[model samples]
Structures are given as C-alpha cells and as structure tokens.
Target: MVLCELKQQLDELLALSDGYAYCNQEVGRLACVQGQQEAELTALHTSIEAQNQKLLASTLARVQKEGAIRKGLEQHQQKLVAQDGQAEVLKQQLAASNLARESLSTTVTTALKKLALATSTQAQRVDSVEERLASLVERQRECEVQPPPGWATYLERNAVSLVALAVAVFTLGLNLLG
Candidate 1:
C-alpha cells in the first residue's frame, strides 16, 4: 500500500509539468502575435501623420490663394467706381457741348435771315436809282434834238457859261450822294 501511494504521487507530478510547458508555449505564441499587431499600428500611425501634414500644407496654400483673389476683386471694384465717375463727367461735357452747338446754330440762322433782308432792300434801292437815271438820259436826248428859237442865239453867245453850268450840276450830284 505505501508503494502504490508513491506511484500515484509521481503520476500527478508528471501531469502538472506537462500542463506548465503547454501554457508557456501558448503565452509565447500570443506575445509574438501582439508584437506583430503593435508593429502594424506603428506603421498606420506614421502614414496618418504624413497625410495630415499634406492636408495642412494644402489648406495653407488655399487660404493664401483666396486672400489674393479677394484683394484683386477689391481693386477691380475700385477701378470700376473710378471709371463710373469719369463716364458721368463725360456725359455732362457732352450735354454742355450740345447746348453750345444749338446756340451757335440759332445765331447763324438769325444772321442769315438779316443778311437776306438787307440784300433785298439794297436791290430795290438800286432799281429805283436806275429808273431815275433812265428818265434823266431821256430828258437830255430830247433837249439835244430840239432847240428853242432864242436858245441858239443864247448858246452861241454863252458856250463857256453852259459848260460851267454842266460842271456845277455834276458837282451837286456828287455832293448829294455824300
């Protein structure tokens, strides 16, 4: 009975030793798997950090471009305002020029009318003077064609006096014109 008890104790000790060895092997396999998972997580973190840096750089560039576009729009708006002011000034000048042109046209029309009226009056005066000259010439021709009975004796005795009278009549005509 004492030998049977010692053999049973030896069997129990061998079974415990086998269980400890199996547990140690399982722990080592789990540790290797954990190490592999940790290495993959580190690689993923590195990729995420690089992507974030790229995104930050892209955002900064976009912001700068937006600021430049806004400044350009503001400058263009200011130029448009200045051009609008110039257009208004040009419109006013055009209006003033139109008014001046109308005034000049009116003045010219009035002057032309007065000139036509004066020309008509001068033509009528010339016609009257010409008719009077015709009548005087007719009278002088009649005088030359017929002489009175006493005229021949008077002309023969006063030829110089007749010449002087003719000169006096011509001088009177010039004085009347003045």
Candidate 2:
C-alpha cells in the first residue's frame, strides 16, 4: 500500500507539470498573435496618414486654383465697368455733336434765305438802272441836233455820274457772288 501511494503521488506531480507546460505554450502563442496585430495596426496608421497628406495637398491645390479663377473674374468685371463708363461718355458726346450739327444747319438755312432775298433785290435794282440808261441814251440822241441848251449840258453830266454808279454796283455784286 505504501508503494502504491508513492506511485500515485508521483503520477499526480507528473500530470501537474504537463498542465503547467501546456499553459505556458498557450501564453506564448497568444503573445505572438498580439505582436502580429500590433504590426498590422501600425501599418494601417501609416497608410491613413499618407492618404491624409495626399488629400490635404489636393485640397490646397484646388483652393489656389479657385482663388486665381475668382481674381480673373473680378478683373474682367472691372474692365466691363470701365468700358460701360466710356460708352456712356461716347453717347453723351454723340448727343452733343448732334445738337451742334442741328444748330449749325439752322443758321446756314437762315443765311441762305437772307442771301436769296438780297440777290433778288439787287437784280431788280440792276434792271431798273439799265432801263434808265436806255431812256437817257434815247433822249441824248433826240437832243443831239438841238445843241447847246443849258439843261441838256447838265443832263449829260448827270448821265456820266449814273454810269459810274452802275459800274460800281456791278463790281460789288460780282464780289458777293465769288
């Protein structure tokens, strides 16, 4: 009975040792799995950071391009505004030119009317003077044989003065026409 008791205790001690060794092997396997998980997590973090940097760069480029486009649009708007101002000024100038042209045309028309009236008056005067000259010539021929009457001599002198006056009027009319 004593030998059997010793054999049983030895068997129990051997079984406990085997259980402890299995527990240690399980702990080592779990630690290896934890290490693999940590490496994968670190790789994922690095990938996320790289993607974030690329996204940030793309956003910055987009913002810069948008700003440039906005600035160009503003400049174009300013130019359009300036051109509108110039167009307004040109319109005003055109209106002023039209007014001036109308005024000048009215003045020219009035002057032409006065000139026509004056020309008609001058032509009538010239025709009356020519008739008087023809009558004076007929009277001079009729009195040629009657000779030295005092009235006849005075009438010849008056006829010479009238001829000079008619020549002066003709020269003035020519000057006005030219």
Residues 4-99 of candidate 1 have per-residue lDDT tens digits of 644564565556556555555655565565566557556755765675566557556755755665565556556655787565555554566556
**Cα lDDT computed for each candidate against the true fold:** 0.59, 0.59
* Model 2 C-alpha lDDT per residue in residues 97-178, reported as the tens digit of each score: 5565567556556755755675576566556655655664565454444433244554464566556667878999999999
Residue 87, model 2: lDDT of 57
**Model 1 off-target regions past 4 Å?**
1-4, 83-178
